[model samples]
Target: MTAEKANNLLEQIARSKKEGRLPPVHDWHPPFCGDIDMVIKADGSWHYMGSPIGRERMVRLFSTVLRRDDDDYFLVTPVEKVGITVEDVPFVVTAVQVRDVEGAQVLEFTTSVGDTVVASAENPMRVELDPQTQEPRPYILIRDRLEARIHRNVFYELVEMAKPTLIDGVEWFGVESAGEFFRIAPVS
Candidate 1:
């Protein structure tokens, strides 16, 4: 997304928030509004490069497990769901972009399967679950150009934490340890 478009989106989100309204539902993830922030590291987790700013913003971050036909894709649920899974996932593709580095831009979709643990209880048939087996699938594609990095922070954070390093460009990760790196505000 371009800076202009992203700024417009932020304006729309701010308006919705001021009126106590929720974000409009889109093809990608279900309409979600919250305080979203991301810290980008410039040199492989060396330091913070920059971050995005918004109020009661729309969170568009997602993870895709795999791809099929034209629409037979799987993604994760919105960030606000009770339990994250492929079934809890939503489908959306608001914008696309290509970074300054080589290679095509990676699209992040939400899936139903995420950090969840299921244990089987039995006297002699106890079984443990594997976490990697539950990772969301990915749909790698090629698209020309890229969208405004408006939600770049959101997408950056998602890919940083979920997807692996593909290029030597900017990378994202959650603010778990860098608590001081992120700042959020309540929705109106």
Candidate 2:
């Protein structure tokens, strides 16, 4: 993408963020205007033209306008929907807060983009084990089908807090949030 076009895209998204209290990207049905060179790396960093987008405010603005249609991701406004590449999920859960609520532990995760979501039935946590490396790829739903991958340290914290539960007579290790138990792994 040309510098002019990239600047235009930024302006459009920034304008959209300014117009709405919270960007209603789900309501925007702009036409697909083709792909942008922006990429969201696995580490939750945004890159444009191969350089990291160091502006935290701008990144937060872009996150508001981000949308996912099926498997593809886009930055949408009332006028345009521009595609972007995502290595894993679009955000990373960098911090976590845990509290007890009515005998249940509620876990709230804060993403790198400044969005916080409490894990529940609606915002469930899931872990995918890599077949080759056997590494755990943990994620939690943020909103509207967008997910944030749990950072390594945060995941370790979760594991430390996990309790073993018996499901169907099988012992499984998991965490509790909002009265729901999300299985992280089954006992070997």
Candidate 3:
């Protein structure tokens, strides 16, 4: 997609968000695959074409091709990955579900659909919400417990202290770990 076209599509999404319309999901066109694209939620769980599945099976939805970096654990979809069309603009995305194994929290990636195998640098692809959540859930969860483990075991190693000493008087910082934080922050 050209930059001009991509910009127009983004503008449409902005308008939709303002109008309180649900973000569009990429419906795969022919030559891509059979299954539909997925959407992510505020809690980092996946809704499979309107059906919600637990984090474990969601992770298994992908067939392990090879391990990528910690940020992106490279894997192939068990089913056909599809090309998603939003506001008439199309992008490829695959459905993915990841779990912490030790924690109930999960990480979901609706990756760009394509057969071009590559390592996950930062985020290998862009994830889109069904327009509605995209408005409210603006903050994307890139690094999570599952991704941390993949980086440690397959890509790179990350060392974290069991406890982090905070600087007193600091208003807030990002969560130190998944289980240790709350999704909905208190309004003060």
Candidate 4:
């Protein structure tokens, strides 16, 4: 990313943070400023100008303005929008907490960017098997089309908490959170 573009993005982010809430990215419709060299790697590390962004606070600040439109991701402000690359999902679920809510299981996930979300109808979990590797790639909806890739250790903990059930004609092993049962994998 050019120095000018990077400064522009940071200024917008700062202004949005001062408002004490996320910018209305969904409502912003700025013309695309073309793709920037910024990328969020598969492990949820942000890179700019081919160098790792070492500051946690800056990464968190940028994440607040992230928006996904269809298949593309952008850092959106009310007046400008710049596209960025995401290797996998833009966030990673670094930790998980399971609690009893009204006698039902409720799983809360903390993302690498420090955002917390609960697994419920509004923020559902899904697993898709890789076509080539056949490995399960699990994700949970974080916000407005953005998802957090469930870390491997957290996924394993979820597997340990799973129960077997029959959905339609297929038997599956899954876990329940907030009274919703999400299929994690087919019975093996």
lDDT of all predictions, in order shown?
Answer: 0.25, 0.92, 0.30, 0.92
In TM-score terms, which candidate is top?
4
Task: Flag regions of model 4 displaced more than 4 Å.
Answer: none
Residues forming the 10-long window of minimal summed lDDT in candidate 4? 19-28
Higher TM-score: candidate 3 or 4?
4
RMSD for all candidates, in order, please: 20.3, 1.4, 16.7, 1.2
| Every model's TM-score | 0.21, 0.94, 0.23, 0.95
Ranking by lDDT: 4, 2, 3, 1
lDDT of 4 by residue, 46-136 (tens): 9997899999999999999999988999999877888999999999999999999888889999999999999999999999999999999
> How big is the positional error of residue 25 in model 3, measured in Å on the Cα after superposition?
22
Tens-place lDDT per residue, model 1, 142-168, is: 111111111234344434534222223
TM-score: the better of candidates 2 and 4:
4
Clashes of each: 29, 0, 12, 0
Q: Per-residue lDDT of 57-82 in model 3, one digit per residue for the tens?
A: 32332211212232332222222233
Error of 1 at 89 (Å): 8.1
RMSD of 4: 1.2
Identify the runs in model 2 with alpha carbons over 4 angstroms from their true place.
none
Full-model lDDT, candidate 2? 0.92
